[model samples]
Target: MSKKSTEQKPEVATVALVQSAQEEEDTITIPVMDIFRQMKKYFLPWVLIAVIAAGAVFGGAMLLSNSKATPLTAMVGFTYDGIEKGLDPNGNEFDANTLKSPSIIESTLTDLGMDTKKTDAIRSAITISGVVPDDTIDELTAYKSIFESTNSVDAAQKLMDVSYYPTRFEIQFAYGNSEMNRSQAADFLNTMLSNYKTYFMRTYGYNDALGDALTAVDYTTYDYPQALDVFSSTLNSLQNYVSTLSQNDNTRFRSSETGYTFADLNESINTLRSVDYATLSSYVLGKNVTKDKASLAIYYQYRIDNLNRNLSSANEKLATIADSIKNYQKDSMVVMAGADATSSSALTQPSEAYDDLISQKTDAQSSVSSYQQQIADYQSRLDKLNSSAVASKKDQEKVETDMKTVCDKLNKLIDDVNATADDYFETASYANSYSVLVPASGSVSNAVSNAVSNMMRPLLIAEALLFVCYLVFAIVRAFIVSYRRNAIATAAVEAEERKEAAEAAEKTEETEE
Candidate 1:
């Protein structure tokens, strides 16, 4: 019984080993050709799924693009000949964000005949950014390295606190929220820029303060002498203005609008002062022209008193300035004229302080002289008023007529000065500081192309992922199908082998019997 059991165990072990070997041999591996064949078989379906996925992605992108409007853009540049210390031509601190101010937006809306209620939308849609150069970082780094090498605390501190503002700026307007079409939005920006330019010119380029002052006084309301004083003051202001312009090297610049140069205007101002103003003053004071006798007496007395006080002050200033000039010591320098040190020359030049003192002394003396002459004139007029009878009607009428003629001439002069000043400023370089370097422009086709370009990368990535997943699915499905078929065939062969082994065993037992 033990022997029979041992033999059966060996037979069972051999059969189990044989079945394991057959199973190992039946393990299927899909080749590249099988994968390729499976992929080809499912190629149309895969293509359809890929097409659907791509269509969905593109459709979503198109819908997203349609929902958000593309912005229209314009470039503007500022160019000024004056010092750029973060100040505009009018000496106000410059801020580029003022481009989208509520006032500007309102003005733009008004100009375009659009409803003002859309101001918020328009302002919100507008954005401004400085167009920085690509080498900005490199330049900044170099600047910092130089300063650090020098160990300059001030320079390093300045670099650390530096804030850069670009001369060029890009303005964008997303008209989707503003309910404006492309053409309308472009016009809005261009018109807004136009209005801003006008505002800039009025605020900074042209100064109407002098002109306003000249035109504001009602000369007819004043007595003859007082009117002459008014005219004198206006002429002085005009003289100062022309002098300032001439000192700025604008003397030869002729205004095409006014047909007058600064030199020509200066000449006109001098002529008015020397001829018209002088003649008017002498005639009025000489004749003792008075609208009211009591008022004239009191005015003359006031003038005399004021002139005496001014004369005293002028005399004191003159004396002090003279003493300063006399006591001032000029700086002296010794220069070697030839190669030999023995040949030396002493040069004594007036210091700036000494020169300034001399200038003050000259001005003080002129003031003193002027005050003395004015006092003398007023005292003579007072004496005439006290001694002489009241003026006749004919005399008063003649004074009135002469004053009218002088006022007319002054008015014409004022007009000419205003025109010349306006023209001069309008043509100045500062007026061209802020301009539309490139006007606002946009195209629908360009917007479409940009939208497509923005979506292209993501679209390609999605399509690539879908293709890879389908390819993996096809290859996996091929392996699974090949494995099942190999497994079924191996099972049938094992069954046949097992049947043959049993028959042989039965035949051997029968032969042994």
Candidate 2:
């Protein structure tokens, strides 16, 4: 071999040995300046490639990190410079809720044409923003924080620009539409948002009719159909009592004795109803039916007392008549000259009465006439009023009427009691069970509580699937980077050396030739 080739051969073999040793591991050791010099050519390309790859990976990761879609958007023509502009109650104040409310959001999205299967992925990738009248610092701050945590933007270029805002609220939502092409991202978000808005509108307005019905009083009644029989019976009894009183000469008419007297009854009714007599003046005005009845009662009692006085006066007159007859018999003695009281004369004259006897008889007859006159006058008056308005007064009638009224009231009271008892039985037996221990409102809230027992399993399953996907993707990314680095190191180590060496030995070859 030539001297030059021979010298280079060992150098190649030594280079091979170094390369083989370095292949097992990656390391760098050189004079600092020489390291820079040795790597100047390769480092430029490697650095450029590394920078580009880093940028690509970072940008790709940013794009992948958030794959959410915009779920709702609404274009309400109205704008509010202040909090007073909109009165969208039912909790429409939260982020995206105002813009993507179930009302107009679904329509807007439908107009935009979004895909359905990418619901969660689009939601995760998207961000929401708004434009409102710049009336206050709050508005500015809110607008500045346009992107949400869910926004996936590794680079500035992935961000969208929003313009065309009025003083009112302008709202938008963004999602990682990675499942869709860049051109289709907006369309997908718009479609899904449309559907979401529709769902929300249906949910929120579910109780509209109930609210309206609650405000209407058309169903209220002074007396329900359930009370028809009771009212009819009450009116019938009152009418019957009035009719009976009208036929009686002793009274003009009578009202049923509901509880209180006439005046008292009316006053009690007004009190219970909490209305003034003046309001009822047009109907009854100054009339006091109760007072009139009470006065009649008094008048009858007075007549009965007067009759008793007259009877007493007549009795005294009878006694006076008896006394007068006795006095006339004693003082009316007529003394005829031959008729002086002689037993012989009285016997001989066939018991002929003397003048004294005659006078006594005359006085007796006069006293009897006076007694007859007094008795006849009294008897005539009594006969004339046998059927008159005051003959019976109210002594017996009062007791009977009072007893009947009391019985009627008791019967009515019993009916009321029975009705109440029946209602209680029906309500308690057939109505929904009541909660005695817990507050009623709390019990109602419990009934309204979510039926999570039916939905929990599916929700948990979805969560688990998402978590698994995230973990797997994360592990796969890490392993790919690590394996690629190791492979690159092995390849570099093998190709780093390009020389081989051979050895030659000759001893006595010249002498034998």
Candidate 3:
């Protein structure tokens, strides 16, 4: 139609531009935003699956955690006496090792009616804890709760671990995963205490006939002071009765005076002294009254001698203290007055030394007064002994014999009573130090929060893992779909190019023909 000049427009530029655009488009690069967008389409399904998986995990964990695998706990308390000799015979302070030793466990299990041959079992089941004070049991209780939750491997670890205090110890025993009765726990505790006590008692020699005898003796009844009182009163009453009897006795050679005069006694003593002193002493000793009197006199004389010795010692001490005081005073006076009394520079300030000297002087004077009083009391006793009259030897012999028999019986009773006193004391100490057993609650202490946390932890982890996997799956699917679409577009583009080339070639062939 325009046919004046048929001109072929060069379409090469357009084709090249289109090809270049196509090539640019052919290259597939997925940015992070695209991947997220692709994943967003399946996000709800992924979330659903994750939730379901988490729930399942949670349920499973709960089922396992709530299952009958909890520990049973018992608590027992031991009281310790602070008596060093009784409790620590080995001179070792009470330590946790003594209670936690394998030997102690072996013995304890034996008491529990478990074969000691199964020591490993006992060791595994029982834990002896540190000693604590009586007031701090709550601290141990809180510790046990925390420890049990975290240390699930040995659930029974809290049960047998011991908490020791200075004056006492609290012990915990746990039987793991048992649905036992509270009474059983009580029985276990009692047996444990009994065995533990028996162990110490036997080890320390407290479980013998002597121990029993000691327990039977009452401490309040043991009064040595009372015995002394009885002895003194009996001697005084006997002396009074003998004095009256001597006054009543009007047998031949009875003096005109009510009692023997000093002159008469002196004359008699001289006459007796004229005789062979040894023979007269022997003759006096044959009669019980004279013998007892002579013994009493000798005892009083010895007491007076001891008092004299003490007085001499006290006097010597007083003199030494006095000398020290005098020296201190002299020094103080020298300091106060100065070397030349008129010299003011030489005068010294009073110091504590003077005060100490004055105090010492007062103490020394008090000691002197005490010694003088003691010496006077000794002389009084001596005078009484000299003035007191003994019965005639013949009549005195019978009364002395009767009194001697009674005295021997009393002495025997006194010895027997005193001998058991120490044993009773030890027994009382054992009782005070003994363990007190109470039934432990058998209720399974479930850490509800901990169990839930433990159960939920796995579920949460699973949910996170599954969500990550889902995200990966969704992104991979997006990449695969995008790749397939790009490959189809490229194939179409290549087919078009081949077709175009074929057409050009045919056209050229025709043109050449």
Candidate 4:
């Protein structure tokens, strides 16, 4: 009986071990229902924490943004026709950064009656960048590839040296530190740009040096021959200027204000040179008119000597240039025989150096001819001075009258030409070269949108983080609660099993007795 009891105890122990293993497996397995209940229970607290976090993030962002001075921005665009070649209409290199030059800023402040002390601030606030197109890089890359594939070292070098500039440029004015309101900043930028346009026109549109020189000349200080020389020089300058204008592709363009074309100006200049100039020159030189014959004779001799020296120098230069031209070898390219080509052929062309030499030679010959003519005129004048022919008071008076009349006509012609040229340049020549394609405009709406977006971005991120943290806390809390309850139920089951085992052992001992 004791032996049977020991075997039964082993079976009872096995059963208890199996029951404990089952209880542990049941305790470790978690149910989806408990998780859902815990989440629901913590939903209100999670929402409260999330709302607080979102509020803090948004308020902080707003406060930080508001504490800093928000920049008032304005944009302006430039449309320069000559931007492709990086040149202005006057063949000067174009620089977009010059838009914010100190000179321009100072002028703007002066024009706007603003404080000139803000010049540096305004310059600092101003930023310029080219509005490069999306395809510009691709185009540049393709160009570089094609040139590189050609295997031409010079072409490759030139390509490497090439710089690109955009026709459209963006001008940004950040006015946070400039102490300017949005409206004021916009006005200042627009005024500054307007002043720049005026400056650009004066600097590059048309040259006023010749006009100013002609206007400043006081012909009364010169004798009759010298006065004739002045008129001749002025006419020659005017003819050359008009000739350059006439050579432009838009030579037929007529000025709306002056009602004159370049062709008309050229015609007027030619007529004056041929008719008025010839008449005055003939009258002055033929009469051998002079304010003081002794002084004039001495001047003529000096001029003759100077001119002879210049003529000799010019002749020597001309001879040297002629020899260079005769001995200069032109660059040539040899083409080997091909299916469509002749046996072999060589093509020759004048290099830039050769062409430059030819041009210099032509100019030297022209200078020599001019010097010879001047020397002859001065010698003739000296000869006339040597003669005992003294002009009477009547001849002098007549000469003076003709001189005044011709001077008046020349002055009038100069005035007309100035007016026409000014009108032509302002209205036609440079009218479209540099322009404000887009005027300065404020970005108030965009600024507001950006501020809102900035605030919302941080707020959303904080809220998302809060949500994840709340979920993890809720899940951990749920697991802790579930574990505690399972541990207590497990302990109770083990106690009950021990109690039952004790009772069974007592019954078995009694049965054995």
Candidate 5:
């Protein structure tokens, strides 16, 4: 071979080997920076496509949200003044749970002529909360003031903006046309209250008409008392009738017994004629409930005379017995002193006289004691009878007064029912202290506000889907670009290798030639 050819061939081989080695090394050493550099070209296009997709999704979501049907919104609150205590009562919460019970809902639907199949929908749409306290209301009002200063006047509402937490027995209806929603909300509240009242009556043992009537009397004040004053005559008549009944009944009524027999009274009266008339009159005047002044005075005189006669008779018999005993003792002493011996018959006569007088005195004293006891027993019975009569009369008067108050309240409640033309409550004699604090009615912009509020979820979902699609496209496009680059580099390396081998073979053939 010539020196020029030899030098050129070695230089070409070395150059080919270096090129092949460089290609192999480049395939193994493609850095992250290079990959990023390649992907950089697609960044703007991918972002643009993603932005377009997100915009389309957001626009569609807004259109759907605005175009969808808006349900009517109705709001109301129940006042629990008649619930005995604060909101949570024993066994009867009467809050959101009670109002939303199946029985109450069914009853309300029946009364309003709504179908049963609409129950689940109605329930889903309806929202019930507890009553906000006055303090909470004040706080909310302050917040509203602040909100008004910082935001639009239309956004600063008292109740609509507050977060619901199932706090109060406030009901919100949102399932029908405006008119139906409003009417049904009111009807549902009334029915729930009716059910609660029935339960209250049954639990408290208020089973009678009077009990029912008294329930309507406002315990908060004496409005019923003043109203009841008009029925004073009726109340008085009832008391008088009760009094008459007491007087007629033998078990209740009793009169004092005068123990004077006819004959004894006649004899005593004759004996009392000797007493001065002034004394008799004075004695009779001191008596409580003295009837027939002259006759009572004569009776008092008779009593005094009869007692004196009994005293005199008892004293005389005592004196006679004492005399007989004294005489017998004197004779016994004489005989014992050895003066003259008395016969047994003489002693017997004195002893017999003493015995007879002693027996008579005992009989007289016993008769007096028995008569005094009879008079005392009669007085005790009379006092008891009078006390019972007074108590019965007082009880009757109290009951009559209470009935008057209840009747007045019942009449007032009945008038209210009639005025309202409430057929359900027509048979009821009274109502409790419950009332509707807030009636159901939708604001002018409520429908639009609700539709807007419902659109946020769909918008977020669409954006998420668009984001995923963009990411997937970007990752897949990046991989494809990398694969194509690597394939092209490999093909270039193979072509270089083939060219170098061909050059080497031609050079060797020339050398061999």
Candidate 6:
């Protein structure tokens, strides 16, 4: 749009000429040997020294790795069940060098010609070390439970693949070779556990004495019921004699009017019953409870019979008096009064007899009352005893049940101990009991796992040592390169000094000419 001022600006041209920078671009090349020679001239000797030192370090490491430890004979084993998959233990070695990983185990076994599909069929007992991981230890712990639950030789041979790098691989027989076949290995393990169970039962399982008491044996062979009956009869005779004596108040010369009340007779009867029952329960029952139940029963029956007989005699006397009073009429009173004291011989004798009968009747009545009270007390005790006997029977039954329960538990414990010995602990030669190489914790124990994890630390330390060596090499290489550059600079400076000296001499000669 601004065509009015068509002034052209001068353009200055700048030319850039491109040319080859290297003059000997196509010159003959030096051979690799020449380059190496040049490097040797500057750095080979020091590099060689470093290499020799490195070789010495490597040799020392190898010696330590080989001559570091003794072969430990502590027997170790592991197995697993209820896992999503099975572990194939590598039979290379068991030591503190590496961890026992299930994945590693499976991979190692797969490298072999074994198929994992048949792993579930056999029981594979793996002998391993305590340095193994918790997951691996878990398998060992499971061995005990599985062996105890369902164990056999067929079960032991189910595994088709085995990775025994960490654990010793076994199929036909164990390392010790107690059995010639896989079946025998399993059988041996199972039997050891069973024997261990018996040992445990005897060691701390049950109270033998308590069991024996509950299942008590009979002490005496006497006839219980017959003896009781005879005792009752004898007691009855004694009671009857006592009653007869009481009825003979005529011999006692007692006055007809002066007599004890029924209350007094009842108290004496009550005292007799209390004393007898107390004595029986304390002495007779205690003495016979474990020794002679038959004798105790007899004694009890006799006490009851004695009470009955005494009551009967007392009642007979009271009845006679009652009958006399009931039959007494106005005419009978007049006839009794008409009888002179010592006149008509027949009438006097009859009066005397009547007086004697009245006295005897009073005494007999008192005795009858005492006996009746005693009988009542004896009956009450019998009722109490019968109730107690019922409760005692129930207690006996409970005791027997408890004994049986304990026995069953003991048997099961024994079985478990035996299985432990057979399946896992025979090699230890321990007492036939539950013997476990109790982990810092136990199988699959956290401490054990932590210890296994510690294996990685040593590996890390080895790597660190290698890294330090690399660092030292790098530092030495840098120092070497710098020293070579300084040496070359010093040589070039000396050559320049020599050339200047020569030129100075030539100039001096030219000046002279």
Question: Relative to the true structure, how large is the alpha-carbon lDDT of every model?
Answer: 0.77, 0.39, 0.51, 0.77, 0.48, 0.40
For 351-463, candidate 2 gives per-residue lDDT tens digits of 23345555555665565565555455434433433333431333433333433343344344333323332332223221221111111111222322322323345445655
Clashes of 5: 5
- What's the TM-score of each model vs. the native? 0.65, 0.20, 0.35, 0.72, 0.34, 0.23
lDDT of 3 by residue, 101-143 (tens): 5676566656666656755554455555544555457766766
Comparing 2 and 5 on lDDT, the stronger one: 5
Expressed as tens digits, the lDDT of each residue in 1-513 for candidate 6 is 222221111111101111121332334343444444444554655556555655555555444432431111123233322111323212322232122233333433354434434222222333333334566556555554565678854434432222123332211212232222323333433333333334434333333443343234221232322222333333343334334434533333222222432233334334433453234334322222222344544555687898887777677668877787556432222223335644332222245556656787878877877777766655654554455432354443443343344334333333332333222222222223232232111122432343334434554565567656655555555556655665687568557656755775566557556
lDDT ranking from best candidate downward: 1, 4, 3, 5, 6, 2
**Poorest 10 consecutive residues of model 4 by lDDT?**
69-78
Please tell me which model should have the higher lDDT, number 1 or number 3. Answer: 1
User: What's the residue-level lDDT of 316 in candidate 2?
Assistant: 64
User: Which regions of candidate 5 deviate over 4 angstroms?
Assistant: 1-87, 90-174, 177-453
Q: What are the C-alpha RMSDs, in order, of all predicted structures? A: 8.0, 37.3, 19.1, 6.2, 28.9, 34.6
Question: In model 3, which range of ten residues has the least summed lDDT?
Answer: 1-10
Count of clashes, each model: 0, 26, 15, 0, 5, 34
After TM-score superposition, the amount by which residue 389's alpha carbon in candidate 1 deviates from its true location, in angstroms, is: 4.9
Pick out the ten consecutive residues of candidate 2 with the lowest summed lDDT.
433-442
Q: Report residue 200 deviation for candidate 2 (angstroms).
A: 34
Model 1: weakest 10-residue lDDT segment is: 81-90
Which stretches in model 4 have alpha-carbon errors above 4 Å?
A: 1-82, 115-163, 166-180, 332-350, 388-405, 408-412, 442-513
| Pairwise lDDT winner, candidates 3 and 6 | 3
